[model samples]
Target: MEKRRAALRLLPVLLGLALAPAAAPACEPALNGTRVESSRFVLSYQSTPIEVGKHFALDIAACSKPGAPEPESLKVDAQMPEHRHGMNYAAKVTKTGPQRWRAEGLLFHMPGRWELSFELRAGGTSDVMRNSLVVASAPVRFTEEEKRSILSHGPWPPKLVPDPSNRVSGNPEAIAFGERLFFEPRLSGTGSVLCATCHVPYRGFHDGRARGFGLEDVDRNTQSVVDARFNRWFGWDGANDSLWAQSIRPLLDPREMRSNATTVSRFIRNNPPFRTGYERAFGKKPPEDDEEVLVDVGKALAAFQETLVSGRTAFDDYRDALESNDVREMQKYPEDAKRGLKIFVGKGNCGLCHFGPRFTNGEFADTGIAFFARKGVVDPGRQGGIKKLRSSGLTLLGRFNDDPAQATALATLYVEAQHRNFGEFRVPTLRNVARTAPYMHDGSLATLRDVVRHYSELDEERLHGDGEKILKPLHLSEDEVSDLVAFLESLSAR
Candidate 1:
């Protein structure tokens, strides 16, 4: 009887031990149909249950038959649930064992549930697996002083500055004439193309291409003509010192309008409607020669482009309420978006680069884009622009300029700042950013979530300029990133 009792006690202990491992949960079940034996593979990460306005990292691992042809190569991908977009995860692979692999990447500004997927391939075989996780909303926590500071500001106005040379700030006739010139396809070398071809009115006045496709392929992205008048300097490289000067570039570029002074002059003088319009605006008949007509064309185009200002968005509404101390209106915005706004201005420190009503300081920075095709061979960016400005006889200070005296001063200042402007590209406005995909000067990023994520977990090596130190890892929670993206989306003109 003693032996039987002892055996029973031992049996109970053994049973408990055997059950412990099973009860611990078997690695959350590699669900989404992940098959271990297959040479081909597909897998996804589990969704992260977090909020907007945060940052997160994803790491996935896989094991295969030791000698199974090394499973070709491992691939990982992720998709945002709410936005129906793919996140730009800077993926990297590490070998954990002979047949085991781990893939990792950072998700910067996306919020809400996201799906991660993995794929494995070996010997013409493949398999896939997927999983989802929820990203929650972030909490708002602003200080009293912060609230006071926000409340002290006022709403931004739609201000237009008068042109120093012509005193034509808001001339409706000039704008109307400029609008006609903008849409006229005859202006280009290929009559099929017009200013509207490169600066599409629907696409924020910018053609959605990497570099513009002109008479031939041009080597620069077409800058947005919207709100060009407000800009102190013009062009991606700031080659043109004024809006009118910038307008003349496309007309002369072989790949753009390809129309010389003579051709443009002939078109304007021969076209009765254009002649009448020009006469009304300039108080003179269209110039008999091409040089004079070309100048008028530049001026007209600038006038039309000046009207492309941004309209109010949800962020602006919230901003106005905050400025007026209207607590009720301010409270109407999503809590996550508000927190994101805080991150943008404070913790995230985005305001340092993106400031003022237009969300840009009109400055340039080297954001570390891979500009060089071959190692050690760099695209000299603004440096090239400086050289072009000096050599091109088209600048305001040059013989072709309508106001060479003032243009000369502007060009001189720009040249003096050449050292400070190397590799620098202008800061783009964030309005309607959601609609324009493939971010940055080079269109390197594919989506806004990717952009937010990039800024959230910026690679220090990529920011090859003076401000890299300021853009440290935000260490934001997943929710915080989402909130920041939400706030940015709210800035889009609806």
Candidate 2:
């Protein structure tokens, strides 16, 4: 028991802790920036700013006094008390020479505060020293309800699932074929216009125009396809229920691809690679009827687009941390973002519609924005969408549906236009929203701040629904507005 007391280890209060230091042993070395001296051992280490979610190495030099016994071994490890968890991976310590050592495979998964400890043991005696590191991560703070609200937004980078309605949903062959067609301008009547011509990859898969320009200017803003698969309805007006049908609309719309079924089928049947890919994807030659051929092509395109989920963002990490009760990891999220998220979930009332993993309810809402397409033409919102859906032959309810039960048919079976839907548009997903800017259905909000401001100063009279009590002026201060915008930006993919 006396011998056990001699080997007793002491740890200094890390960061802001105020623990009493243990009486050090006789082997203390001169102190330096890279070196820490204790009574039983001297340890030195070198490292730069530690990065989160990545493995890193620490080169260490440790020694006992000249007359002292050599240590039997060294143990290295790390943990965060606030998070109530240790490193997801264990680091290996190796002796290089007389007193030189290296620790490898050290990683900080969630960033905030961490403690790295090194223990030197010899003949049942040990000495320990701890280094505090604040790994770089986006800092955030939250209230209890805010935590609950954020958690609802994810487990993110949502899983990709096959569309039951589209027979070629998850086929890699179909995805590759669709990818090729996406960049193929030849599918269009005008040779210069390709799907890629508007939905540029670098531009976050949005056309980057106020109104989409195809053969002629279209009335609505180009919605980005980053996580389109998760949506219940497609397009700004919620015109299409299935992504495949949604893809078909643009190909046939004169304002968009401006090509008929004959033109697209000709292109597919004439091109050897496309024809071969069509067969591989569909298990048959291209259909003779232009409409049948169009359906297959749309399915291929939807398969590829489903793979476009936004990468996990800072909000995802922070939300996860909060859910796991990791205080240290939660601290890494920016305070500004935290405040903004609070406003969004609470005072701002944005969550009424922008709720769920994709940050949208996948339903339509009237935000009271002006809907004028030009001088006198009105862009009738969901009402127009319903009329179009009912009148069109390209819907999930049509004979083109390969779905045996027509699983995507329920919404179609029940959907009907109402007077309240006159000015309502689909509630757009907010994932990667920072990159898809010029907000709202008309691209009327030039900036996200403008969108926030619009809600802050909304005109109740302009709202078409008399019973719609949700839209009211927020009267947010300038700082609150800034905070809200900051939170919204945290949703962008890193």
Candidate 3:
């Protein structure tokens, strides 16, 4: 029995040596297939790369050697030697000629070491030939289009441009003052809640909760402050055209800090540390007008928030490698991630909304998630945002804007609320997405997988009739779902 097992192990090697042409490279498949031979039979076969989760077929030609007894039949099969499990699907065999055959419907669903076995039987005895290979954990290759799409998500840490509407946007002194203001709990009505209370720096700058909790519950998810400098609009509803205006919102909201302009202005003017920082930032003491002081406070806070850019992620490394065609660096990225990225750029159509280096188009869309805040009240999303922007004095259209030309206010000047905008919400950056969970405007989904599943099984009936017809059910397989999640996780810092 031991001798027989040892002979079986040497069978494929012996057959390969006999069949390979004199000039052919050893242990490599030829253009058509790998050829093998033995004393009784000679066989040649070809197969595509045996990728996990993809269906493939095999072609084979076999015949008895001259002066050797002809085999009565041939059988083909495969198994994972360590796993002791064969393929889930059986191949359908077809005999095309006296010495040629085809096998269809072969599939490998898992990645690992696998062995393909070809058995030839004559009289009452059988000879089995086996070939072994490994299924890679990452994908084998990417199409040119796929490579292009993947490359577009990178270069990481986009250029920082000062806000034209806020004069102190790039001032180092203002940024320092802003940092102090960020952690100042006195800015809140409760004196215990700070901007850091909700936008926790250690927690990816957005408190990891389903909904933001300031003095009370906020209706939407607390988006990360990281990479906010790149946004065209702020907040889930796109309600604030400027980051400063958006900053002032939570300060006065009844459910948030609940501090009025008077409370905020007086606190900054009276508090020695704040007063000194404020003076340094603005080049003077706090102004007499309470509203002006409050706006300045928001501006200082915005200045601080602008610097919270996230670090480079694994995907960025892969993207850079791909851009330079560095095969060695690209291979360091997991194969599962590559497969997942293919789905993201191709079948998922996620790139349409989550585009650019920021991985967001900086716009709003109604993704068919329910918008009802309660049984009787619905969150009016972008519609409410445009309405609020039109009425707000903090906008670039207002006198508070430092820009004489109001150059940055174009989106504010022309944006009007439409019926289709009712459920539309701003697209958030995918940077640090894996860390900021409880996703969506309402924070309804709990995980990255949940968010993917939401799109995978989207209900078209719930979508706005007048909205862009981009979303539909993905109906992804289990492997596809896992692949997409892996890709999304790669977008985050390691």
Candidate 4:
């Protein structure tokens, strides 16, 4: 039994030797049907039609020089010429007989002319042959449902409205003032950690930590501010209704800026640059109320942050290519990424919550991540968020809100926490997601693969009782997982 198993393992090799030619120009046997015959060997496969997106197989027979050692092995693969990409699925080759081989598991995903190539080897001799076939299928089409889903994620570089909640929202002078304040460290109680301390510019504005660090530590991971203006909710918990209000929480947090509203007010009021910038941006004088000044600072910070939108990504390029029906351009995108995208909107169901231009629906969900922050602490997530928003006087209900109609503030007024809100964190944007790691609200997962595996083999027991029922273990194959990760990484901004 052991000898038979060993022979089986070596079978492909032996078959290749039996068919390999002695010399590059050695005579090959004549054969018919979808074949390329050369002096060294004859390579042939079935002439059956290969419809795109459909799996098909054929016998790849080879005949070598008469005196050549029995062809040792045969290997077969296919590539789309225009796409310049190989088949997403690997082809399997097996020996059927002397100088005869069968290849299976061939699936051409795209419609285009394809090159079927073969490698034949015997002992130290080897030869290769190629045959071309135009494999095509029905023209590219998508259901109305799919088209809507795909289109919603784009219309890129969304129009910027610097600060809809504040009069300075789109003011250029305010933006400049805010830009200066963003890099100021004295604003923090530590007098060293700037806003850019956690939100580094080059690393896609992500601090790249499992949890953010400031004067002490931040419980959750630091989310990138790239394209942050699109987010209706702020923070992993959606604790703040506006970016301005969101900016204040970090400053007041003991672990973050560790500064009081009074201190922030004094610092800005005392600094000539800040005062001058503030006067030019918001008017001649800063607000007298300490708390009000602090709020204004947050607004300035928000103005600058809104400018940090992400640039175009590889996925964006591919999406544009698909839109224009530019086959040549589209082929440049990796097959792995395309397959991963199919899994994303299709089998993976990631598109449901991660939707829209920035790839988030701006909602919260309990996606099975643990809630514990410390030994006795548990994050109440969006539940806590709702409570905090309702009690905060700085909300849209307050005088700080510039929108008298309070259009964007309606969501806050209507929001109510239920059992489902517990453990729910905001859905983050997928743009530049590849640069922001480790992932998840808590950043417990270390890599994109780890996040994929977490969902692929989700722990049902850990999921919140009222969490999203749509989530389930994917049970994805290894290749599928790889493709999915590749696709997600493609979302990174250039």
lDDT (tens digit, per residue) of candidate 1 on 333-439? 88767877787777887767777677777766776666552357666666666677677665666554444356435644546445546667777776667766657
Instruction: List, residue by residue over 1-494, the lDDT tens digit for candidate 3.
Output: 99999999999999999999787332222225776665677777988666677788888877676566666777888999998989988878787676677788888877889888888787688878888878866454768987788888878877778999999999999999999999999988879889999999889998999889988887888998888888899999888988999999999898989998999999998989889999999999899999999999999999999888888988999999989989899989887788888898888889999998989999999898889876788998999988888888888899999999999988888888899998999988898899999899989999999998889999899898787699989999777888889989998987
TM-score of each: 0.68, 0.71, 0.80, 0.77
Residue 26 lDDT in candidate 4? 53
| Location of the lowest summed lDDT over 10 successive residues in candidate 3 | 24-33
Best by lDDT: 3
Per-model root-mean-square deviation over C-alphas: 13.7, 17.0, 8.8, 12.3
Using TM-score as the measure, name the better of candidate 1 and candidate 4: 4
Which candidate wins on TM-score?
Answer: 3
Give candidate 4 misplaced runs (Cα > 4 Å): 1-144, 324-332
How many pairs in model 4 have backbone atoms within 3 A of each other, for residues 3 or more apart or on separate chains, i.e. clashes?
18
Residue lDDT tens for model 4, 324-392: 778899878877787788778777889888987788889998788999986799989899988988888
Model 2: lDDT of residue 267: 92
Q: Candidate 3 versus the native: TM-score?
A: 0.80
Regions of candidate 2 where Cα sits further than 4 Å from its true position: 1-143, 465-467
Identify the superior model by TM-score, candidate 2 or candidate 4.
4
CA lDDT of each prediction against the hidden true structure:
0.68, 0.83, 0.86, 0.82
Winner by TM-score between candidate 2 and candidate 1: 2
Query: Residue 71 of model 1: what lDDT?
Result: 60
Residues 121-221, candidate 2: write the lDDT tens digits. Answer: 88688888888877765444457887788789989876667888888888999999999989998889887688877788999998778888988988888
Q: What is the TM-score of candidate 1?
A: 0.68
